[model samples]
Target: MTANERDNIRAAMDRLLAGIPLRSNGALTIVRLAEEADVKRHVLTHRHTDLKDEFYARIRAQGHVPDSGRRLRERLEQAEARLEALREENAELRAVNEGYARVVNLLTLENTELDKGDGARVVPLRRP
Candidate 1:
């Protein structure tokens, strides 16, 4: 990319990172941001190393770097908390599902016994 394009892309990213919400379903992924900023994905993903210093320098010149770090840390902590809560919820759901599975298995066995007199076979049903 040309110097001007690179600068524009960097500025767009800075704005996106600053303005985009970090909450669930709120944050924009790198690819999405790149698309929104009209920058090539490869430039954002691979060419970033070449641009990092200049990008940081520009943002620093614009007085955004120091506060950016704090904002990033706060967002990271919120993300971690959300992840922890999701994990706990997943564990609870798994426990409840296991309970349901056991109950279903027991009921199936009892049903088999009850159907033995009719010579009925137990076939697994397919789920939609």
Candidate 2:
């Protein structure tokens, strides 16, 4: 009714946006919205008709502005596919790295032996 009271209702609406769940757990209801906003339900219904309409519109909209559920689902699927590809690439790289390690080890041993045979200084190999 009063300007300060209306401001309180608006503030409550902002808080409700964060507390209300999207779709999985539980949808935002007027009752839950009032609870989060710390205001009585009547404040939304009688005192501020515009706020009440906005609240219901948001619930109906289900945050359709940015990415809707369908789009989010597609993106999630794409991400999962990309993750699988990365995992496979990681496995392949590990195998290649292991092969390189074995070759490096063998070559280092061969070099050490040659150095000893020719009286050349044997340099210890440091791992990179």
lDDT at residue 105 of model 2 (Cα atoms)? 100
TM-score of each: 0.43, 0.43
Q: How far is 83's C-alpha from truth in model 1 (Å)?
A: 0.2
Off by over 4 Å in 1: 1-65, 117-128
Give the clashing residue pairs of candidate 2, or none. 12-37
Give the 10-residue window scoring lowest on summed lDDT in candidate 2: 20-29
Question: lDDT of all the models against the reference?
Answer: 0.66, 0.70
Q: Tell me the lDDT of model 2 at 107.
A: 96
